[model samples]
Target: MSETHDHSNEHDHATHTHDGKPIQEDPLPSLEAQILEASVRELLIEKGVISADDVRRAIDQVESRTPALGAKIVARAWDDSEFKALLMSDSDEALMAFGVDMRPTELCVVENTDEVHNMVVCTLCSCYPRPVLGVPPAWYKRRDYRSRAVREPRAVLQEFGTQIPDQKQVRVHDSNADLRYLVLPQRPAGTEGWDQEKLARLVTRDSMIGVSDALAASDIGG
Candidate 1:
C-alpha cells in the first residue's frame, strides 16, 4: 500500500522501527542524489518553503484512512442484487446507497467474471477512485506495473500469483482522467448460508483488485 511518512524534522526519521529491526542504515539515496536533494530542500527551507510538518501532515492524512467508501460499495453490492444492477447501470446512484458520491455519473464499474475478470490500473499517474478506494497501492503506482499491466495484465497478475484460467476472459481497465473503475469480484460458492458480515470477512483486498475471488466460509478465520 502507498504510505505517507513524517519528515517534519530531520530527527523524525530516527524515531521509526521497522519490524523490530534496528535503524542501522538510512537507505535514503546515493551521495550524489542526496546532495542534490539536500540542496533543493535547503533552498526550499531557506525560502520559507512549506514546512516539513505540513508535508508530514498531508502524508498522514493520505495514509491514516481506510478505503471505507470502496468497502461500503462492495458490501452493498454483495447484499443487494438490485443495487448491484443499479451499480452496473448507474454507478453514481449505486455508490450513494453506500455513501459514496462521485460527481460525474459517467464513472463505470466492471464486475469480475468467471471468464473475464477486471482490474484497474493507471499507466500514467496514480489516478484512482479516491472518494471510494482511497490511494492506490505502492506497487500499483510502480512504472513496471503501470507500463506492463496494460500491455500484459495476465503476465503481471501471474507475477502476483494470480492465475487466470486459460479459458477465462480478462478485461483490463485503463483508468484515465475522465473514467474511474472498481472490480466486483465474483461471490464464491458454498456461501449460500453466509450473511453479509460473514461475507465481508471473505472479501480480501486482492479480490477487490480482481487478482483473487472472494473467499468461501472455509476461508474465514475465527
Candidate 2:
C-alpha cells in the first residue's frame, strides 16, 4: 500500500553538510583566466595603482555582502505599504533608510504583480547590486542566461521552474553601465501577520534576482 508522506520530513533527511567546512572533493585545475587576473593584479600593485591592502579590503568587502541584507529590505517592504511605495519610487533613498550603503551605484526596484512579472539580467556582464544582494550566481554570469533572458524570458524562467501565468506579462530588465534592477516579489500567501524576521526567511537570492518567486509558507515550515 502507498503511504502518505510529509515532503518536508524527507527534505530534512536529505540535508547535505560538510562539518561546517567546504567540501572540495576535486579541485579545479588552474585556468588561463586565473593567471591573467593574477598578472593584472600584480602589475597594478607594482605600478602603485593599487596596494595589496586595497586588494585585501576589496575581497573582504565582497565577502561581507550576503542575501540577508536584501531579504531584510524585502521583508520590510512587505510589511509596510508606504515603504514599498517609497522603494519603488526611489530605491536608493529607500535602501538608505535600511542602512544599505549603495554608494556610486544606481538601484531600481521592480515589483512583481499579478499582471506583470519582472526578471533582471546583465546582457554585457554581471553588473549586479553586490552591496544589497551579494555576488551574482554563477548561472547569472553565463552567456546562455544573459542572452536567453532577454530573447525568451518566459522559456528561461520556465527552465528555472518559474511559470508565469498566460495572462501575466513578463518584463526583462537589462543591467548596463550604472543601473541595476532588483525584483520585489509579492508576499507569499498564508504568511499573514508574520514578523519581518519570519518574512525574511521566505525571501531567497533567486527571488530577488527574479528567476523565482518567494518561498511559500509550507516550503519553509510556516
lDDT of 1 at 183: 85
Clashes of 1: 2
- Which pairs in model 1 have colliding backbones? 115-169, 116-169
Tens-place lDDT per residue, model 2, 90-156, is: 8878888877867787888999999999999887657898989988898887667777888889989
lDDT per model vs. reference:
0.68, 0.82
Candidate 1 residue 116 C-alpha distance from true site, Å = 1.0
Best by lDDT: 2
Candidate 1 lDDT, 1-222, residue by residue in tens? 113443444333222323322212223333555677778877876788777777689878767655555655676687889988998998877666666666662557788766788877765556777666667777776656666777788888898788888898888887767877778888777777656766677776667766666666676753
Model 2: per-residue Cα lDDT at residue 152: 85
Q: Total clashing residue pairs per candidate?
A: 2, 0
Every model: Cα RMSD to truth: 10.2, 13.7
User: Which run of 10 residues does model 2 get worst, by summed lDDT?
Assistant: 17-26
